[model samples]
Target: MVIPILMEGKSKYLSSLLVIILLAASSLAVHAQEKPRIFVSTDIGGTDPDDFQSMIHLLMYADRFKIEGLVSTSFQTGRKQNILDMIDLYEKDLPKLKKHSKGFPDPASLRNICKQGAIAWAPYKGFRKSTEGSEWLISCAKKSVTQPLWVLVWGGIEDVAQALHDAPEIKKNIRVYWVGGPNKKWGVNAYDYIAENHPDLWMIECNASYRGWFMESESPKDITAEAYYPNYIKGRGEMGKDFIHYYKGHIKMGDTPSLAYLMHGDPEDPQGQSWGGSFTPITRSSKTIFNRNSTVADTVATYGVIEWRFNGPKINVPSDSTVFTLSIGGQHWPGYYISEGTYAVRYSPKQIEVGEYVTISSITELNGQKGTYVSKAPWPGKPEPNDFKLEQHWYGDKPDQELFLGQQQGAKTVSKHRKAFLMDWAKRWEWLE
Candidate 1:
């Protein structure tokens, strides 16, 4: 009788333990489902090596977000293989990372989603043709998931622009965080295309806010960009060791702030406090229209959209498609055909205080037209708040504003939060051990 009584108690205790295990697993599954869906378009391994550093940091935090796609849009020389190589390094450190994080995705899965984007910059129309990277982005954005697809543009905006040109409906499902200062200069045409066409699309254009990631921080020396790598990152794991290879072991991950913005606080409110810094709404963009070719005496606002209209020989073709190439400042741009003999092209000036020569050439009558134009600073004045019924696009505050750190516009907003984010990142680095 005593043995039977003991057996009955043991059985009940085992049943309770099983129930606890099942409940714990269910909680983990729910947490995984709740993670935000993210897609990354980077120009890694192209002009600067800093992208490599950003990629490494992103892999370490893979467990925190649902990484949907990784695309390389290196207009200079970056390729998809660059991302693949970094993933191989992450695989080596996966065991340790998994021990600390619950949802570290399989390395194979990440490789499967890696894709090559545009190898060259977009033409005048802001997009040339779709590449594998753009196609993958479109597919990921089309997913029926409940969460909005977060597009983190770390490099050129060519792929993002192309995807939007192909499928404008996806605009409703994506949120963009673009590190767009120097990158904007490189992909001005693509930037202009999106800003003009998708004015209502949700975006956080971190022109200067991303500068805060590596700016002066009040954190301890051991965690600062200069000392943190040697103290907490170097020799910790394969990912840590690979990180030192770029920027001589110093952190200049200007692009990481996009990820940081999503890391803490409510991302829905751009003006609110977060690790990624805050931004104000961009109510308007400068646009100038001309019916004839421009001359050197004509000046346009820097980064402002420029549109030229021309009447050429009538031809039947797809409207809004690349029908002619506009050469300006020695670069070829795409021009589109409207109904009748009208041809149009849109361009954004990337340089200030310099005159750029322009020329138009095509097989049609719209050939051999020549002109020049000078790009000046942005038009002076405060832009009114966005009144668009759709989503608002955010940009850094003006330079004279108190939000700026140094000469870079809209930098201080990000620099102020440097310490908090660096400290949090330090804790994640410890997981590599």
Candidate 2:
């Protein structure tokens, strides 16, 4: 028989202390589970009108993530007016959205967080100057005591790069996700400068794969103005209408995936795959490292010449033994190599079609060692169906700030799981019910 332990003297106090400790631990665990802290810097009012659509999508779910800072950074549309205009509409819709969930922050609260970054286009060098946006980013990243801040660069990443440059300590507190592709053409110099300097910084470059938002039209009837806008989204809510209003009712929140990935929970994992897409690791010797590191870089367009340039101290490979090849979209094309300052290999496809899943790759064998690099492309990245454009804007003195106004092939990728993202967005709207 065991003697019953009675609560006497110190035993009673000891039990009480244990209970209090457990309760404190539970509270800390719940706090740890709270949503992530996020900082968003956008280039809205730029050449493409889609950033407005993305802003609307983000505002609707303002409560899902802790929005620390909202910065307006642009190469062309270098003003905060666009973000303000969207906030004005958001102010009106906040109440309606709040009814569904209590996570929505007050409109004034968000407005207070809004600030403008560098107004001048990015210079040839990295972090040429600082701005209110960059300083805010640095401050926000350092002030956070809970979790790492996810920095979504919906436009150029000059501000993020600047923040890291100014305060290297924040590297332990911030992560970056940049939407490249056409934007990369403009920020190539900055991108190169940052990559060379901060090679180990946590950054995700999402280029072509962002096209998954547009979706491939199954029939001529789908994705039309009347069907998608008026029939499906026109009456959902102020947010829905705003999306279709200027967007003509198309689902082109191409930048939405950056936040959507966070919305899916566990923003730290990029390999498991979620609404945002999956990614793989790459090395410096990787010819297609930029594309391969990105999830959607090759999913948008079925045909395009992907050029890979590798810069190193000295690649001791013999020219006669070096070979390059492009493998994607069920066809393979040989690539031509040219070495001036860096090693360059360009791939052009022979058989390719739009609205189909396509991946671009450049494989090389140097002196006897072999390496293969692969990635996806968006429709805009493709030149005219049969024509090619000069990639001068990528490295020249000026920032190439034009939309890749290439002619659409009237076909979309069949493989992108766009419907999942669409359905998730619909449930948030009251009218959709």
Best by TM-score: 1
TM-scores of all predicted structures:
0.76, 0.66
Show where candidate 2 strays beyond 4 Å: 1-25, 217-226, 285-417, 431-433
lDDT per residue as tens, model 1, 1-433: 9999999999999999999999999988986558889999999998799999889888989998889999999977789999999999999999988898879999999999999999887665678899999999999999997679999999889999999999999988999999886687577678777876888778887666677677674556776778878876877888888888898789889899898888887888888888888877766666667789888777776555667788887777776667777776577766778768888876666445455545456654777777777765432222323212223564544444567564455667778787777777778789877
| TM-score, predicted candidate 1 vs. hidden true structure | 0.76
- The models' CA-based lDDT, in order, is 0.79, 0.59
Could you give candidate 2's per-residue lDDT for residues 1-433 as a string of tens digits? 2334543656888999999999999999998778778898888888778889889888878877889888988878557788888999888777777777888888888888898997654433456677899999888987848688988888877887777778878877777777665566455445655655676667666554455456554323534334555545667766666776566766566677778768663556665455665443332311122222223324323223334444323444543123443344443323223333244333422122322222232333321222333322333242333232222111111112221212222112211445656656656665333
Worst 10 residues of 2 by lDDT: 391-400
Model 1: worst 10 consecutive residues (lDDT sum):
380-389
